[model samples]
Target: MDHRSETGHVMFLSPERVFYAGLLGRPRNRSTGSLLIYVGLGGRLMLTCGGRTQADLAIALIPPFVEHTIASDARSSLCFTVEPESVTPAALDLLARRAADQGPALAERICAAYVRLREGGCGPGFTTEELDTIVLGAPLARRRLDLRIAEAVARLNDFSGPAATAADCAAAARLSQSRFLHLFKQQTGTSFRAFRAHKRARHLLHFVNEDLNFAHLAQDIGYPDSTHFCHSIRRFYGLKPGAIFSGSRDLRIYRGAAQAEATAVAALA
Candidate 1:
């Protein structure tokens, strides 16, 4: 492994999606809402989930809300996450099975794409579709969801504002609370509360490169207090709030270009 490759890390973050190429910090159990694909950059990675541990794996896929831990023989890895709501369940399941005993062919392609991304000086402008095509050979099919559920999904992605509640979204969608909750799970394969929690924790990525106080940062991102904030971060990321911040100090972070532009335009409005 080239020593220089391990020194620089970058993260690409968009709404409900993330591509992180960096350190594989100390392994700890984490259950996340997004489907995860981890590829070891230097060599095979070890994976443990569902009472089974697999080694010598070039790639591994973990479904949403499945508690799992991963570690690699190398210093860095390429991790990509997809929001389950954006793809059909069947598509996700097929990928998960393929990754369980995945070989090096597809893994090699993904690693090569990462090299191209780094060498091309690609910034926030990169789209998820582009990433899918480059690495997966094609864009994963999109899920056609109910309009009402889609409306609620849009609100959930805006984690920087007040947390959206089931009641609030149900009312907005002209449905009763119970019915909305049922429909949400049926359509998205996760409960509203669980999805919201993941989004809130994921939103912290936007601040990884910023210097800020933890307590204030917690409040700004819709957490009730710093304790709850720290707990949630650890649950989903396997790292404490302070540790995440400190570790990402030198990492290059980029938000989706369209998202960044939208935020800027809203600010100037």
Candidate 2:
């Protein structure tokens, strides 16, 4: 098999979202908190979930927290991860339709946008709205969350800040813990714990290119220990922490304005 790595791929990162176009390393089961959209760049893609394998797929949309393994015959792919809380049900339904149809039209547009961003000399300052416009033809309608739930969501998404527990967020929102958890699920369409875990895993992308100690990194990200960190990373990304870092070495990452201040290497290209 040809083992030459595809270098110089691009990734755009923003709050509650990520767009990645790069190598699809060895596939393993991964269950992530973000609704996943996978688009093949070359040959057909294969997706296996729930004991069933679907082959010759050009596009697939997998909901959040679904355990699945995906691979592309071409060895690389275009993937977009939409945080469940960010979009309305209607938008998600539209995405589902597109994915179900194996949207050649949508996939072609997304591929063009990727090419534009990669060769256009753009930096990481783009907003999520702009990203949506370029890739999906318009901004995805935002889900209107409750004020209290929105506050809690903000706290959880701010990965650079001190970790906030459910109790902390509940207290800040002035609600009982039970009520808070219930409302969080109702508004976000995910449990508070699952959302937090996904945020922690997503935050790892900010430091993927850096040389950092795993133990300390674990603590920095609020993981109880290195073992938990490794397990969570593997669960979400289907790759070990070390493997993620190594694979991302040649990948150029663009962080939105919110993350640019927290991660200096977001300027890398």
Candidate 3:
């Protein structure tokens, strides 16, 4: 293993996802809201899960909120955390199951995209949607969701206020608590609470670059107390808040290309 990838670089950050290129110091075991695709850009990596180490991999796909650790040589790597529903299911399953080796092909495309960005041929680098499209090829069949349930998901994603409860979601979707709960699980393949928590946890992404301390950051993101904030961070990212926050210190966080551009403009203003 190379000892060179100890340096880390963050390329983009948003509420829904983030992309990183460069060395990632040891990451916390916190679960994340979106699916994680850790692409090995240079040296080989060692991914540890459930007390085991998976080394010599070109890429790894981790499902949301599943705790794991990655040990890598100090080499360049590219990573993206993509929104669950926004990514095509076929692509997600392909990487997650490890049923086949798509690593070489995926790596080639990523390298090309990186090269193009470095040459300033494009602006804002690659995006989650673009990467998903590149990997998945054509569109795949989507799960048929109840319109009401789908509306509820939209609301969940958009809601910025207090933590939404099951009752609240049911009301928003215009369904009884029981019926809505049933449909939500069937349509989304996860319990309502888990889905909502992941959505809520994603709110922390916006503040990744803020100067605020944990207390204020927690409140600003709608966590009830420090305890809840810490717990939520752990569950979402599988690591302690302090570790995650400290690890991201040098990251140039952004919500999107527009937000990043706006921030740059404001700095000059």
How far off is model 3, as Cα RMSD? Answer: 5.5
Candidate 1 vs. true structure, TM-score = 0.91
Off by over 4 Å in 1: 1-7, 100-102, 265-269
Give the winner by TM-score: 1 or 3.
1
Candidate order by lDDT, decreasing, is: 2, 1, 3
TM-score of each: 0.91, 0.92, 0.76
Worst 10 residues of 2 by lDDT: 1-10
Residue 197 lDDT in candidate 2: 94
- Show model 2 residue runs off by greater than 4 Å: 1-6, 262-269
lDDT of 1 by residue, 1-269 (tens): 54434556778777756878888788988888999989999878999999899998899888888999899999889988999999988888877766655657778877887887676545666776776776677877789889999989878777445778899999999999999999999999898999889888888888886799999989978899999999999999888988888877767776776567655665676
What's the CA RMSD for each of the models? Answer: 3.1, 3.9, 5.5
Tens-place lDDT digits, model 3, residues 119-222: 44333534444434443443323445678877777666642445567898888878899998998888777788888788777766655544668887677556
| Superposition error at 199 for model 2 (Å) | 1.0
Question: Alpha-carbon error at 61 in model 1, in Å?
Answer: 0.9
